[model samples]
Target: MAHRALVVRGGWDGHRPIEASDLFLPFLERSGYDVRIESSPAVYADAETMAETDLIVQCITMGEITHEEVSGLRDAVAAGTGFTGWHGGIADSFRASADYLQLVGGQFAAHPGRAPEPSGEPRDDANFLDHVIELTDLGRTHPVTQGLDDFAITTEQYWVLHDDLIDVLATTTHPVRPWHPWRRPLTSPAVWTRDWGAGRIVVTTPGHDPEVLDDPNVRTVIERGMLWATRTASAS
Candidate 1:
């Protein structure tokens, strides 16, 4: 039977959830996945639906998830359903739910180049910029990142609050920007993987713009990550 996948997308429109998700739909379909796309978080609350799913691809950013919704999704992942997503869609999602944050293993703390003014004023400057991504030894060896070289991409460099239990795949240094308060360069994980119960989770911190998703390297990483995650789910 074909693997079943659920793609939940919505929340902040700045991430271009629909466009980003759409970019990968053809790939998923051609890979023999029975993909279902939903715009509502309520889909997460359906226990029967969750139980039947082999993978969950989420693109909801900075949104709220209910107790029931989180519980159902958590149970599915814990029972060996694969979960994968990129950028704010995964890391910056569900700001109010610690349970959801803990399951994903990271939360967006800040991006170094821009910060709110001390006087609580918003700046008109661009938040996204270019940076180099260096793969770790683990990333070089992992299936998701194997055969890939260090690449530079222009996007939001997400600085995340993450769990140490995760396997770091790739990272980038925070460039010294005038808005940043730190005096030195700080490295942040750009991609990672973790296990929850019998399931697998993969996160990539690029893809802030639709064009970023179109990058061949970025698409390769995501495609391999999804396949790896789906395989894990099937094995479970």
Candidate 2:
């Protein structure tokens, strides 16, 4: 059977969720996934309908999934489906849903005023020559970031707070912005993967803009990550 992908997207427009959702179509097609794109969150609510799905690619941010929807998604993944997404799409989704957070293994508490400065001087919301992260001890040997060197991108380097259970892939040291008074720099995980029962989940925090997705290296790694998180047995 051909592998399948269900891309359910919607939420904050600032992320250009639909456009972001569409970015994966060609990649999935090349990887042999029959992809379906949905513009709403109802995909999360339907159980029997989503059961046979081979992978779930979410782009929903800061939205709530109904209990029925959440339950169905969990059951589907536990039965061996894959789940993958990036940034606020997966990591920061459904703030009120603890079960969702526990399953995905992380949450977006704060970008730490990274979004806006106090004086309102628009920092590069897109690619800023900003420092990218160095792969930490746990990240160096991980499949998601193995052989990957420290590279800089002209994008917002994410600062994430992650759970202890996740296998980290890559990370960056974000310096304190003028918006933040504390001025202490912090190391943040930029990518990670975790298992949810029989399911595989891969999450990356680097894709905040289309250009980031356009980067050959970033695109290659993320495309591989999504495929890696799915049921593409023939892919390798």
Candidate 3:
């Protein structure tokens, strides 16, 4: 039987939720998944549907999720359904729900620009600078990132706030550009995985847009993440 995959997308349109998630559909289909698409987190409230799901790929950014919906989703993942996503979709979703944040293990903090700015806010197109997504020694051996080398991407470099509970797969450093306020460099986890109860979760911070996901390295990471995060047959 094909693995059941659910894609739940919607939220801030600036993240291009539909376009971003659409890019991975062919890969999922070719991988033998019976895919279903939902535009709202409300779908998570259905217990039976959650029970049957083998994997969930979310693409929501800065959205709201009901407590019941989050609870249902949590039950699904804790019971062994795999969950994964990239960029703001997974990392910055459901700002109001601590339960959801605890499940994701990371939150998008900010994407600092090329130089110092008077204030900080989300950047969509202004900050296009080259940065390396460097894989760690363990990442070189992990299933989701093994065989992948550090790659350069000229896009938004994510600065995420996360707990040490996750296994860091890759990292990117934020250097102090001339006149920048911070005196030193800061590094953030660019890719990671979390084991939640009986399930696995994956997150990649580089896919800020389809253009970034178009990078072979980033695309491969996300594709592998989906497969690696999928629930095992014994999970039920």
Whole-model lDDT values for every prediction:
0.87, 0.76, 0.92
Question: Which residue pairs clash in candidate 2?
Answer: 127-154, 127-155, 128-154, 128-155, 133-172
Model 1 residue 172 CA deviation (Å) reads: 0.7
Q: With candidate 2 superimposed using the best TM-score fit, by how many Å does residue 29's alpha carbon deviate from the native?
A: 0.7
lDDT of 1 by residue, 143-220 (tens): 999999999887778888888989999998886667667788888999999898888899998888788888888889
TM-score-superior candidate, 1 or 3: 3
lDDT of 3 by residue, 24-71 (tens): 999999999999999999989999999899999999998899999999
Report how far off residue 13 is in candidate 2 (Å): 0.9
Which prediction has the highest TM-score against the true structure? 3
lDDT of 2: 0.76
Model 2: residues with Cα > 4 Å off, grouped in runs = 113-129, 176-179, 232-236
Q: Would you list the clashing residue pairs of candidate 1?
A: none
lDDT per residue (tens digit) for residues 1-236 in model 2? 67878998888886788888788888899888889888776776677657668888999888778787788888777767788888788888888877888888877765653445568677654234466757767667767667778778766656676789888777777676665666788887778888877788898887776767777667766787877788544321
What RMSD value applies to candidate 3? 2.4
TM-score of each: 0.92, 0.87, 0.95
Relative to the true structure, candidate 1 reaches a TM of 0.92
Give the TM-score comparing model 2 with the true structure, all chains together: 0.87
lDDT of 1 at 199: 86
